[model samples]
Target chain A: MSDKTSRRTPGPVYVGLDMGSSRSKVVVIDEAGKLLGHAVKKSGTDFSRTAKACLDSALEMAGAEFDDIAGAMSTGYGRSNVGFVTEESKTEIGCLAKGGYHHFPEAITIIDIGGQDNKIIKLDAAGHRLNFKMNRKCAAGTGAFLEEMSARLDVSLEEMNHLARDAREMIKLGSYCTVFSATEVLESIRNGKNVNDIVKGIFYSMIRRVLEMDSLTERVVMTGGVVAHNAYLVEMVDEMIGRPVLLAEYPQLMGAVGAALYARDENQSAGATTAQASSKGE
Target chain B: MAAGKSTTRKKIQATDLMNQVMSDYFYHLNEAATSGKQKVAWCTSVGPAELLRALGFAVHFPENHAAMLGATRMSTELIPEANSAGYSPDICSYLTADIGAWMKNITPLSKAYPGIESVPKPDVLVYNTNQCRDVQDWFSWYSKELGVPAIGISSPKNVVEVTEGHIDDVARQIEALIPTLEAISGNKLDMQRLRETVTLSRECSELWKKVLETATATPAPLTFFDGTIHMGPAVCLRGTQEAIDYYRVLLAELQGRVEAGVAAVDDESLRIYWEGMPVWGRLRQNSDLFAGLRTSVLASTYCSSWIFPSFDADNPIRSMAKAYLELFIVRSDAYKERYIKGMLEKYRIDGIIYHDAKTCPYNSNSRYGLPQRVEADTGIPCLVLSGDLNDLRCVSDEQTKTNIEAFVEQLQERQ
Candidate 1:
């Protein structure tokens, strides 16, 4: 049988759960580091319930049973709420860095614009984290800011993205605060500004907020749900920074994939230690 | 599957002695306020306690009282009151909280010690701008409200080196204060008494420095949180035998812990240097957080501010000026970088956490690209925590915990 076919009849699988503020995500991977399946859903108020549901969906898609999980790790804002995780929970920053490095495998800065916070993590060529910074105690440049702005502009998030892409001219926003920007958005509407231009302006404001947080490295990788939905933002970043930025294949599931990678490595290390112990005893 | 363990670090035995020392200090201040037997002089914490003591005035530090208000979780509510009274929220929270407590006619003192109705009424107010210009403004407001004489030494700031000229200027200012202090205390300035008080302060400072130096030991026996509480006597009772005696006991206890190889935090693998003012209200929370992470914050700029090594009893005036001007808060960025690098080597620090306190810009060192510079120079990682000395509103406990955990993970990755 082929290795892929053999893996499909899985004896064991590793799992990673990212319990974020807005959405919960889970990824299942086999011994060979091949992604088997993944699932994402709204986090809502009950994190524990949402985490369990995501895990169940991911496992179902992977064609694996509960007994097949060899190891599991949790991460994100609600990481501690995931009761099924078998190892110590990791921070979203470390997980995102690991996930981004797994794809790029180069010196790069990872800009993760998440639901509640934005993180800029710089890594060396050896996959070592050189430095990192998170947004200060504010939601000015995060996914929540976009969501709030969408509601204020009376447009669906997807429509906002489309409008931003089709804009003839970008309308620049003056306020960095979400509340203040909402007032500015109303004024733009009163001035009979094009909705498409205003939406592009909101995108410009969000990009400006993240860019101003820290200087970007030569190789920048953009990830998270914000980038997953708003592909136009990558183009905007390219135009602003005068360089192209890489996008993760599975942006929203990067943290979950990173957690799975950790679980796989840890389980292998434990197995190797046990094997060495057994040989010494013999 | 399971939650992480909570911090279970053993409390230092010296804490009990610190409590007794602080209670007695407040009791004396209460006596001065109520009985009017002694004139009460409100001085800044880093201001000249020796001068006031020599002039026969009972010294009370409003900064210390403001710290108490923060520790007791009263500052957050009181800060807004000061803001409503036309004081901007961006000024020092210590100033706002103290002035607000005054406006509300309440003091944590009354709750801590029996028969203490309020803070001691100041007969005169004195300040030094070595720490920040805020102290003068903080003291001036009270001086106006109470209709008392206000005087201050306008020391030069961002001092790279405390030159002879700087010492001369500050010394002349301090000497000029003798007339007003003498007028308030109804006593002549006795040079002999001033020398004796300066001698006592020097002795107390040396003992405090030695106590802090004990943290150089691997798996430090005491953390910065311990020093913050135990520093009460050094701040309030300096220039008195009480502070000297208290430090001797505290130092003995710490030395015993070092001999026994007892660590303040269990499995203490990471030694961190805290580069700014503490989140005063969350001392216990922050302490437990670091301990739970197996990280010991062994040294800090805020706690080390009281260790005036240049104090000379022989040349009291000049030495006091040099010592106060040499404070970490008053130093330029270049000087601060060198000092922090020395501290990193001294403490064997694995990381640096700079608190960017919202209100106290003078003490917040992270805003000026210092963290990146320090990290690049030392090749040791640095994390900046956003917090305030007195305002809990400026702090986010969840965010702080996440950032610290990630920073620790990065340090571990380096290892």
Candidate 2:
């Protein structure tokens, strides 16, 4: 409730803000890389305001003040707009790879289906990125696609997921384009196709789209707000990939977590450099 | 790899002379078009320009003009005019933009040169399909519209090895064009003149190759962006002494930079090989983006397409046929892979970026699993960027910037 600049605390905490297109998420972590608190809010037209609000709520939960923050990093579509980040904003691909590796600590492929884009990042055992791919200049495999299909199906996003789970026979939509698939959904409704089946088909279409973007590694970790809300999609991906996949503790907050980890790592390295310089002077 | 410190790129002094050279070249073409004293021949960028020169004709390249339209950002507006006239949007934007500009009675040339109303009107339009069949269709459309004789050589496609048979076929085709060229120019083909022109072209190509090879030095003297611009002489004035002379100047400037340790991109820690057509509309933006990231795009398949190692003045016709046939665009995937691998090693390239040009499928090499194969064989990473050579509508600036940044970060991590 207090102004951020006026508050003071005793210890240092790192901050990571994933200012994505659909949502702004902030994670507060201690010096030991342990998550202290996190917050997520809708990222409307004004990204800067949303980022501040998420940071305030997250800091409040962590019982920390502005003076306690050691370093900060930002990622995602709105990263550049976040004025408070101390480090150069990283790409969502790098943040995702770092966050995913923190969880598994091994060679893993991170699939992040976000609001307007989807990413598949591959990282080695040492947390170095091997390769990464983002969906081409189309909205087909992202959360935006699901929202459009849900709107056409006359259901809320949550209702669509629930309906998908209830379907006995999955209806397959033929078109990959979000607009064309809406028309196909209308045609299915005209042909007396089951609504639940149609909803399941939409989920299947989204999963299929991401699958075609790139081949997956053996250890696949699913993250992002889409999978966080629509758990059925994760199950579908598992079924499709023919293996169990790891899910981050907070799927939508993984990029923020990754950004926080970067802040911590960078701060420690700077401290080591300063210590070495001072010791040499002595 | 730590990020390189940002510094202003060293300007190549030859650009001033290149500007004058280009202005004079266009001035002569306009003079020929307006004065009606000499015949003006429209040739493809990689067509037999030496032969055209020997036959006593002033040359104009539409591909060069289309690139100007693209660089000046005029193609996006004019392309619709051609699309409205039934040219598919999926074909080469170079063809569509050129035809579209012609339909609109506009050109980037008019603005660059005072008193020039449009591109030089052709007395004869010649094409070589070694690049693509689209050039033949493009030239044919203009031929029908202007009632000019359109002559072309149907060079073999997906050529793996340029056999003597292929050379003979193309040689006879070149020989076949003489009658029409003589009729149009009101001059006969002079073998001695042709041989002289071929010699000039050979010298010019070697100098251009040396200019590009200067990037093999640490902290490369020039970037691929520089090559794309400085290549103007090599592409448009290949058969003339002016081109040979201009390259000698450019080569010396580059060599001076290399000796003095001046780099085109400051702190050039990462060296990259660009594997497809330059995103013509976004050249400055892309160039600055890479420079800011401290990555030097030192080599590319597109700019090197003009290098004709096969040109031999002693056997001008057959060697010209061999040179034209051995073009990189016409080569098979296996041969292309080998060529790219060699370039990566030659340039000490740390990474490769393939621009999957939407309209230029012939030049876009990323679609056939070439990127993965190269990465696998060479242990160098590759990034595929989806864009077009001339169509700005197909390119996503924000997406491309993010991809390049991430690719640089990935490479840095490996280091």
Candidate 3:
């Protein structure tokens, strides 16, 4: 009885804590399936401390405290760390399914990019995702390279988008490493080629990885922090995937929202089952 | 290392080196059986240690024996046992050695040498699943060959420990194992003893997890690889007081180092993942190259294979039984993502150097675009350094070095 009391009783409100390879992520959702409020914060280098900070910040942004939250969940590389979060914490699959379903009920593919991994999930019309393909281990065409190359180019992310969108010709930089990309970018600048061309090449390379999905159907839902920041990447992915990439209104908040949705479902089911059992005259 | 001979004539030379181990083995076996103190050992996938100590009514592990054949300097000779058994030479060397040992029926009954002919043989066999699927195939053969019951802990694909349902599965497996365990130890299935063992092992494993993460902070207490081997005493001889003591010392060393801010590598310029298995022949040199860069493999899919948290203690038996379902190497795509995210979070890995192990299909075969995927998801740059995991002849030491040097330069540039 004490254990039951100590453990969180299923309640309304859910949160998503995406423990990423490069960063941490969080989101919140209220009961009746409403997005009360959401926030995005950088994940930490040290998970225990970093995740704690990310969680705290998200809670503050939601205009509440951690105690105010009725339930919580986490996903990403850091899900295990969130094992202590709640019993209802779902895997990235269920979160993405929930978020993607909420965003585009017809969405079939859900793509998420974090600091160090990328995934192309295939969802059904109900946003019920099927088997998905992911490339979290490899970094050839991921956001890390883009961020690295952007740093090397000494161009701000905003400038990168502006320049990439305006590039005259996309030079096949063929530079896989950000180190090599930097060298190539610098050399191209030294050789009097526009830095924008190299930046375009870098974005295209990352897009190539995302577009490699075998069954990338229409209604693709894109999530993760980078999705909101890099429109060029989204646009390129859209063109490359051969479909207008769907966006969650709060792409970064999807994981958290999904998590909160899970929490709400847990409470709803618990309440319904208990109501039925009590009504049965027990 | 002394070249201990195959035949009896060289026994004298081998005497001084292994006399202590042989003496202890015999003494413990006789004393335990006579005193009716049953000893069982848990298995770690990477080394021979834990299972070796558990022999004689205690469980024995072929996995560690296989690791010895893969990683030891003398891997060349002992490893062929796998190839002789028709296993691919390019497979995990440990599996080869394990398969070879199992096929030979070299249990506790098998005499260690002519000197200690009285060494009691291992009565029960235990196996650990590697992140590689081959572990399942390898152990299936062991089960068939030994005819003695073989207990296996299946690795899972899903990471969430939501329900205690896994405990139910674990309990079922443990229930089946009781009769075999009883038969081997010549003791009845004592429920109290099982509970004690489970409680102690769970405590020990939890400590190990704490110790592993303790090294992640600045001046990391130890490299993930060292911890992988050091974990030997716990996973192998767990369910005993010794395991508790061993962890205390190890944890103390780790905590001391943490307090002192003793970085595992003094000048770690970068931390990289060794994508595939090390080319067995060039293990030292390849490791050295990284050490030069202060880029220790803080966590790797391969090295972290043994570091899984068996936290679902509500049911210890099935938890142990279902343990394999979580091996990062063997899990499905979704499972791999979960592990990747955890690794990046648990260990402060800056960059990754993906090594496509030369002939190890199991180690090498992964999602083709994972490097990019990882980079995008984590925002860390990855250098896809194409090198085979184990074919020494094909990999060029110099070329690999140049690539590593360049990769480190990228990390340094970021700093």
Report chain A TM-scores, every model: 0.95, 0.94, 0.84
Tens digits of lDDT, candidate 3, B77-182: 4446668778877676556655554455443223433333222234445554435556666656655664545564443433454245754654464455555655
Write candidate 3's Cα lDDT for A63-161 as tens digits. Answer: 555666776766655565765555333456456667777767784778877566566666655454444444533566666766777777788766778
Error at B120, model 3, angstroms:
7.7
lDDT of 3 at B400: 60
Instruction: Point out where model 2 deviates above 4 Å.
Output: A1-10, B1-7
Model 2 reproduces a share of the real contacts of 0.44
List model 2 lDDT by residue over B64-177, tens digit each.
999999999999999999999999889999999999999999999889888899899999999999999999999999999999989989999888888999999999999998
- Lowest summed-lDDT stretch of 10 residues in model 3 chain B? B1-10
Structural similarity to truth (TM-score) of each candidate: 0.97, 0.97, 0.48
lDDT for position B101 in model 2: 96
RMSD of each: 2.2, 2.4, 21.1
**Distance from true position, residue B266, model 1, in Å?**
1.0
Write candidate 2's Cα lDDT for A187-211 as tens digits. 9999999999998888899998998
